[model samples]
Target chain A: EPEVTQTPSHQVTQMGQEVILRCVPISNHLYFYWYRQILGQKVEFLVSFYNNEISEKSEIFDDQFSVERPDGSNFTLKIRSTKLEDSAMYFCASSRVQSENEKLFFGSGTQLSVL
Target chain B: LAKTTQPISMDSYEGQEVNITCSHNNIATNDYITWYQQFPSQGPRFIIQGYKTKVTNEVASLFIPADRKSSTLSLPRVSLSDTAVYYCLVGDPMNTGFQKLVFGTGTRLLVSP
Candidate 1:
């Protein structure tokens, strides 16, 4: 089965630094998403992107965060001025369609650690 | 988005069938119930999805009643490797348009030998 692929499985950065997480969603998928989970917490939606534009975003995705489909296959999440609270496993997901019954394919996740 | 309620945790033995129930009292006409499983340190994996009635795949079976107020995810003959957290989500993608899923605290399932 095809899967979403994220690069730099582990990232360590200092507070106030900039970080960019990269993901390659399934080739045929049309919708992309970013989600995060603090250790031992429920997964939280960050943002969704479709047709090269942001479809929706959560409050957690504030000015510090942005997503871009830099190319045909690569989707990226950039966080500027990272804080200690930014430490978490960030996941990338994709779906062929944005429907009530469509299932998302998720990557293993990028573990972002801000010191 | 309809809120879901499920047990916080469950314990089972290897070779036993595990059924995790999730309740969504406010499910809408277009909402669908979907289940995802996550092992430690990994992203959630899709298991099964159903709008109503029973939907079964190679991995698990989803049973939704006529009222659609609740759904059950049945794992047949579970093993220790099956230990994971299972999430149940309810949403209407057509209405919301590119809906971002809201994941609640999922049920933790531990299968022992």
Candidate 2:
């Protein structure tokens, strides 16, 4: 089965540096999303994208965060300036639509570690 | 988004049947009950989902009562490898735009052999 794929399974960066996590969702999937889980915490929604534009975002997705689909397959999340609290497992997910019963395909996740 | 409540943890013996229930008292009519299993250092994996009644797949079973206020995930003959965190999510998903799954603090299961 086709699955979502993310790059840089792990990333370590300085507190003020920039970081980008890349993902390639299933080709046929039309919608994409980003979520993050701080160690031992619930997975929190970051943002959702569709029709080549952002649909919704959470409070945590402040001005510092941005998402882009640079090409047909690659979707990326960039943090302009990182903080220690930004360290977490960032996951990429995709689905055909927002069907109540639809299942979202998730990548293995990119572990971001900011020091 | 509906709030769900689940026990923090559970313990099971090898070969025992394990049932973990999640309560979403205010689940919307269009919401679906989905369960996911996660291991440390990896993303979560979908287990099973049900709108109502009982739905069973090769990996596990999902039981949703009529009120739609609660659901149960049943694992048969669980083994040591079955040890992991289980999450129950209840949502319409229509507004998330990506079927974005909102996972709660999952129920951690420890299987002893």
* Top candidate, metric DockQ: 1
- TM-score for each candidate, following the candidate numbering: 0.97, 0.95
Q: In angstroms, give how far residue B108 of model 1 lies from its true place.
A: 0.3
Candidate 1 local lDDT, A20-91, one digit each (tens): 999999999999999999999999999999999998898999999999998899999999999999999999
lDDT of 2 by residue, A1-115 (tens): 7889999999999999999999999999889999999998998889999989998888999999999999999999999999999999999988876666778788899999999
TM-score of chain A of each: 0.98, 0.97
Candidate 2 backbone collisions, by pair: none
True-structure Cα RMSD, model 2: 1.3
| TM-score of chain A taken by itself, candidate 2 | 0.97
Tens digits of per-residue lDDT for model 1, B4-65: 99999999999999999999999999899999999998999999999999999999999999
If you assessed candidate 2 against the hidden native complex, which CAPRI class would it receive?
A: medium
Clashes of each: 0, 0
Task: Give the C-alpha miss distance for residue B21 in model 2, angstroms.
Answer: 0.8
